[model samples]
Target: MTKVAVISANGRVGSLVVKELVERGYDVTGFGRKAQNTTVAQTYIQKDLFELTKADLAEFEVVVDAFGTFAPETLHLHVEVIKHLTALLAGTKTRLLIVGGAGSLYDDPEHKTQLVDTPDFPAEFYALAKAQTDALTELRKHDDVDWTFISPAADFQVDGKRTGKYILAGEELTLNDRGESIISYADYALAMADEIQNGDHIKERISVVGK
Candidate 1:
């Protein structure tokens, strides 16, 4: 069985990724600050997200960095963990899969402005958004370990249903017929797991939107 470790496996998106991977028959391992409520993982490792070492991740074929933070002051944790993990996993076969935000997604095909650059962007999540975008910059600098960044649509619905269908795109934000950008976490997890198994978007950022 392929071993996969999901960092931040207890978070909203992380937990769904865990379930997705588990259902696919991968030997999934959950790593979090505390035990998760699911039985899908074969093992659960409780450790601070910042304190993790490569040795802790050496066993997995893929490492999903699903760690997320809402606190504005400590939003840097988003980039810090990416920096540390890429440094450790460099030159190894382990692929780094980052759970990215929509902030980094470009607003136009010219790629001049990002979604976060818009005036109507929510201020409450601005700090977190900036941190995630910076983290993408950090991922772009590394070529050692294989990496894939997956960004959700602007309206990420926490309570949305798992339609098991989503539109995949490059840097540009995708939208539905109503011209709204959205995707459910369940479908996002589905696409993410499919990416890990397919290896089609290595070292690139991909986006998912509702159909």
Candidate 2:
């Protein structure tokens, strides 16, 4: 069985991801924002990430940083947390899977990545998402054991078939005829857990879209 840790595993999307991982028989740990009623994971931590020690990263084989949503305040926290995590997991042979913002997906064929090129995506949020995207991109250059930064679709709408069926591709956005990119949270979690079970698409920053 694969042993995995999901940081920020108690939120809406994170919680679902944790459940899916646990159901897959992975030794899963769910990091919660604060101590709460718990039973979803093999082990549960109440403290936020600021309290995470290298010892925490040492506990699992793969760590998925999923502790955030689309909050602008989280951009700095995302970079700060990832830098801290990369350092903590360094030289340990432990894998890292980063979940990133979709703003980086471009809607227009002629534009810069939709998030980076758009003048008006979300004024308060774009910069931070862009920063996180850059952080994930830079991580790929490291000669590490295993690292993946998986970006979701431009339309990562919460409601959709949870079927794990989806498309995985490189730097370009996978768009349908309607011109919207979409992937369910279920599929996202499935892909993450599948990677933990048996690694694939390694050391790459890619995007996922449902058919």
Candidate 3:
């Protein structure tokens, strides 16, 4: 069985990812700052993500960085966490899979503008979006660590239904049949689990959208 660890496993997306991995029969462990009444992980560790040492994660084959923050002041945590994880896994066999944002994806086919640069991008999420974008940029600089960044669609629906279907794309934002970029958290978790099993897009950034 493949061993997988999910950071921030108590969060919305992280929890779903943990559940999906568990359902798929992976030897999964979840890391969080506190214990939770409900969790799908076979093993749960209570520790601050930054406090984790390389030895602590040495046994896992893959690590999913599902950490997220919306607070204006803490938005920078996105990049910090990415840097920390990449640094920890550098020169190691463990693969780092990051939960990224769509803002960094190109808005046009010519690759001229990113979604974050478009006029219609949400102003409220600009900080978080930019931080995630910067996190991707930071991840790209680490060549020693094997990493894959997966960005959800523009409309990351918190309550959207799980269709168990999604489309994967490169750096450009992908739209469904209705000409919109959107994905439910459940479907995104499905895609994440599939990617973990496939390991096809190593050292690359991929996007997912609802079908």
Candidate 4:
């Protein structure tokens, strides 16, 4: 019964991750603004993300930060929360797993530039994408905490179902046979749960896409 806590558990990706963990028989808890999906969690906490302290999370062996926002004004908080969590869990055994965006993924094998740096990248998602990229940067600076950042495919499917099949890749973006970088939220959760159980990518960044 490994203990796990999922923040932002009400969101699309977060909820699916909670479901995956729960079905895997992990002792799971969910924290969010709303407590709609109580069945997926052994226990649910309704609290603001920032209001949660390290003490509140001390019970879990792993904490998954699934927090996300599309608004430009609050994008900086993405990195802020990372800094806060790193500082709080600096000397503890609790591991941090971040659900990162695909913007930071490399456009090529050389790893010269991220997808966000490409010329054709959409302007509307620039701020949010860069913020997620910066969050990964912040995680890299810390040597005291054990953390793993998992990025989704460039084209993440919100309504996609769980096929329980996905391809995992390193820092570079992953593509399918048709050359599409996409993954369903349900399948993404499968990859995430696998990482939690295996701990194979500790202190590293990885990505997943549909096979």
Candidate 5:
């Protein structure tokens, strides 16, 4: 079985990723700052995410970074954590798969404007969005690390159900036939699991939306 570690495994998206990976027969482990009442992973590790070193993660074949933050003060941790992971996994065989944000995706066909720069972008999430954008920028600088950053659609619905269908795209934002950029956390998790099994987008950034 493929060994995988999911950081921040107690979070909404993280938990579902854990569930999906486990159901797919992967040897999964959940890492968090604290233990939760329930988790789908066969093993759980309680430790600060930053404190995790190469030695701690050397056993896993893949690491899924599902860490997220909305607080203005801590938003920069998004980039810092990605840097930390890449630095640790550099020259190693393990793959790092990041659960990224759509804010950095180009909103126009010309590839000129990002969704975060649009006038209709939510003011409340600007800081978080920018932080995630910076994280992607930082991840791009690492050439030795095997990494894949997967961004969700503009509408990342936490309460949305699994449709078992989605469309993947490149840097530009993608829309369904109905002209909407939306994806449920469940479907996003499904896509993540597929990527983990297939390893098709190594060292690339991709986006996904519901079909």
Candidate 6:
């Protein structure tokens, strides 16, 4: 069985990822800031992510960081948490997958990625999202962990059931005729899990959406 460890078990996306993995028969372990909904997991470690030490990361093959939300105020903590987690997972074969945002991707041929250089986006959110993208860049210094930064569709959020369908894109962006990119939350979880099992887009940044 693939020994998988997921941080942020309490978060909406994290819980769904863990639940899906468990149902798929992987050895699922969850590290969460809360105490609820973890009984379904193989093992639960109740600890805040920043409080997690290098010793705590031992023996897990896959570590997915799904810890933050779209809320603007939590951006610094999100970036710092990823920095610390990558540092802790350094010097090992353990894989690191940081949950990224669509703000860093190209939404139109004539425009830059939505969040990086856009003036209309919220200032605090823009700064922090930019920082998160930068954190992924700085992580290349660690070379030990196999890292992947996954940016979801602007509206491809979690909070629903699995749809088992999504489209994987190779840049150029995927959008509907109406000029929008969207994927259900469950499909996003499926993509994250599928990447773990398939290893299709390792050491790269990719985006996903539903058909």
Which structure among the candidates has the greatest lDDT? Answer: 5
Candidate 1 stretches greater than 4 Å from native: 35-39
Kindly list the per-residue Cα lDDT of model 4 for residues 44-103, writing each as its tens digit: 999877888879889889999999988778899999989988987888889999999999
Question: What TM-score does each of the candidates earn?
Answer: 0.96, 0.85, 0.98, 0.96, 0.97, 0.85
Q: Residues 1-211, candidate 3, lDDT per residue (tens digit)?
A: 9999999999999999999999989999999998672578999999899999999999999999999989898988988998789879999999999999989999889989999999988898899899999999999999999999999999999999999889988999889999999999999999999999999999999999999
Model 3: runs farther than 4 Å from truth?
none
lDDT tens digits by residue: candidate 1, 1-211? 8899998888889889999998889999888887554546778888887788878988889999998888777888888888899988999999999999999999888999998988988988788899999999999999897999999998898989999989998998788888989999999999999998998998999999988
Better of 1 and 3 by lDDT: 3
**Per-residue lDDT of model 6, residues 44-150, tens digit only:** 98888889887788888889898775566666676677679878987888888877777677657764554556666666556666866666667656667788877
TM-score of 6: 0.85
What pairs collide in candidate 5?
none
| Consecutive 10-residue window with the lowest summed lDDT within model 6 | 110-119
User: In terms of TM-score, how similar is model 4 to the real structure?
Assistant: 0.96
Task: Single out the weakest 10-residue window by summed lDDT for candidate 3.
Answer: 33-42
**Could you tell me which 10 consecutive residues in candidate 2 have the lowest summed lDDT?**
136-145
Clashing pairs in 6: none
Q: Report how far residue 1 has shifted in candidate 3, in Å.
A: 0.7
Clashing pairs in 2: 106-114
Which regions of candidate 2 are displaced past 4 Å? 37-39, 106-115, 118-125
Q: In candidate 3, residue 32 scores what lDDT?
A: 96
Better of 1 and 2 by TM-score: 1
lDDT of 4: 0.91
Q: lDDT tens digits, residues 1-211, model 2?
A: 6778888887666777788888878888877776872537888877677788888778688888886755665566766777777777777778988887776666667645566566767666667667776676557556654787788877666766788677776666677556667888878777766666767767777787776
